[model samples]
Target: MIRHLSSLIMDNVSNVKSFVLLGFNDTMNFRVPLFIITLLHYCVILFFNISLVLLIVLDESLHEPMYIFLSSFCINALYGSTGFYPKFLSDLLSSFHHISYEGCMLQAFIMYSFSSCDLSILAVMAFDRYLAICRPLHYHSFMTMRRLSQLVCLSWLTPFCIFSINIPITSRVKLCGINIQRVLCPDWLIVKLACPEVKSNLTLIVYIFHGFFIIWIYTHLIKTCMRSSEDRVKFMQTCVPHLTSLIIFLFVMVFQSIYGRFDSTDSSRIFQNLIAIELLTILPVMNPLIYGFKLTKIRNRILTSVYLNRK
Candidate 1:
């Protein structure tokens, strides 16, 4: 019985093309206000992420491997926001509800590509921090500019290569039957709709997305806690921000996974929508807040820049 069910899900479609996304809802009631709110949030995030990246790149003071990784993630964040926001803004202002199949696929690909890059970069940043704090002697030689540049390139390239393989698999399957139900046609939801031998894709994605990141971050974190003899206040200051970000990500992922698995129903659908908004909108707002307020370097940079401008 299990085998048969697996076969049913795993079979690849031979023919058919294109999909029509149902998209959150067709109601006129909530579209305009939601659109405006989403636009404002995305603009702020884009500006912050891009400005930070530029500042890191231009400022010789911020030229370390740590800042390099942060800049790379900032670029990914910009790409991530770009993939989803323009469509959302258009949908809100113009009431353009339809997306071409090509458009949807491209959107899904870009979103996940950036997201995957960000995830890997975050892991790399954590490792960089571990090396700096826990193994300070080796940090300079180990994380040089040349090496950091290579790592940044790899972080960007890795997702493009992996997603290129998986996207072709998705392209082979037709989306004629299933309808997407979100403002952004997220890759996860799109893959679920594509009738492919999807176990391989799902398994790979889970490994990359969930498995690697969770293990990598926490493992280093445990090592840091064990080794650090620093004052409690100093230790907690760094630990708390990363810990909070991780908790929020885990909570959202857990709920979203459960919501994805549930049968298509109104209540389940509502829960998923709520989760999506929080993941996209609320999290971006919190990220800058966490990093800006918690990290001394970032806080001092902002204050110094402000003071210098005034002078």
Candidate 2:
């Protein structure tokens, strides 16, 4: 009887070739407007992130550890946004909101890696700030070009590798359902469709560890800044943007998590959809604006370039 049931489960899993995203079901009347709005938003994300990345790469005066990390952050934002927006915009116009099994897995992988990479990069930025402020004399010796390259690579690669393992495990699961309630396929939602129990504890543990590490680093930063006005000024200029990005990220993530746990029927579907896409929409636009205006070096370089181009 167990063997027969297992075969039935396998057969059912084989049958689920695509997932219907019900998040857009209620938006029939507003699809055109949503499409235009989302398109403009996506364009802004691309423009802001890409322009920042280019500005960093082209300008030699901005070649510092902090700016480099900021460039990486912008690039990751672009990477994550690209994974979602094209398909999203396409779906907004199409009558059917279907994603292939492979497409769903790929989207989930991109998003998971993107999120993990964000935390990792932010943690590295916090560490960089800690070193710059707390150990100013040792900062140069500790954060050499080679070391900076390694940190950037690890920040991007580690998350990709971790999620590479995760997506395959998810692929192997016997799925009993073909409907994903969200606008995009997140790993947890995929796990939710599985016939048997599956736990993504590793992601949670990694995120929690990064969170605590950033907090610990900031605690030391606060104490150090309290003693020296110079250090305090540095903190306000550099760490403020990092902290703002972190806060925005954490807020969106926490809201999404809390919203996911509650019954979907409790909230309006439009509100649910908004919550679902906030991470992609908010962070990409906000981070660049925050850093572009907040960092004196970057801000000045941008103005100089704009003034030169206008001439």
Candidate 3:
């Protein structure tokens, strides 16, 4: 029996090419409907995000700091959505829901970094709004195009570099199992599949540092917005949309995190899948919608472009 088990283990090591995603319930009769719903979700995500990104790029009139940041936000939405949706939708329709080891790592990298970068961009936007509202005279001086470009790059690159830490750690691990419990490769899920020695302290500190930085930025924005009625209006006008998006993103992240860690009971698979996917499904739509409708210049530009295209 001991020799047989050893052979089995060696066979698994040699033959394990992909992981089975156990998030879907094979007994469920709604796979077709589920596929349709997920397909529409992807379509909406692509429509809104790509439209806004094009709007920002084409309209030189909207080339200010806020719009530029909004463009970055939309692009990241596309990035995140693409990471999840294509594979997810395909899995929903397929008989076998499996992802290769390399594919799983890539998905986790994109998904995690997309989220972290979203938070980073939001933090930068919050700071920019604070400067524009509270220190109006110096806003232009401080947020010059060159500096704004640098901030944009920081927002994009910082999270990419931070999340890349996990890839090496995960790669070094000798995975014991070839089953991932989620539809997509979330970092935590991927990490869990690895051997026990992968210390998560560094990743934890990176997350904590990111959270604190975002909180600190918002704290200053709140303090500054308190002083003047005019600044209050600016905050309500611009920051409110950002605040709304931030709250939703944070809520989705927290909800998913909780469910991922604690909820192990054999419950509803559909509900499980929904919670796992809420962030990717929700944010791509929410970010572009909030910025598109709430920000006057973007709205107007979109309208003007639409009207002109009709002509």
| Candidate that would win on TM-score | 2
Q: What local lDDT score does residue 30 receive in model 3, on the 0 to 100 scale? A: 84
Model 3 quality (TM-score): 0.90
lDDT tens digits, residues 131-188, model 3?
Answer: 8876789999999889999999999998888778767777667766666666777767
Each prediction's whole-model lDDT (CA): 0.66, 0.89, 0.80
Model 1 ranges with Cα > 4 A deviation? 1-18, 24-27, 194-217, 231-239, 268-271
- Residue-level lDDT tens digits of model 1 in 94-139: 5345566678779878866765675667667666666766676898
Instruction: State the displacement of the C-alpha of residue 295, model 1, in Å, after optimal TM-score superposition.
Output: 1.5
Which of candidates 1 and 3 reaches a greater TM-score?
A: 3
Candidate 2 structure quality by residue, lDDT tens digits, 1-311: 32443454456674677788888888889999988999999999999999999998998888899999999999999999999999999998888888988999999989889888999999999999999999999999999999999999989988888888888988998888777777899888888887775777878787889999999999999999999999999999999999999999998887887877664687787787788788899999999999999999989988987999999
Q: Residue 267 in model 3: shift from native, Å?
A: 2.9
Question: Clashes per prediction?
Answer: 0, 0, 0
Ranking according to lDDT, highest score first = 2, 3, 1
By summed lDDT, which 10 consecutive residues of candidate 1 come out lowest?
9-18
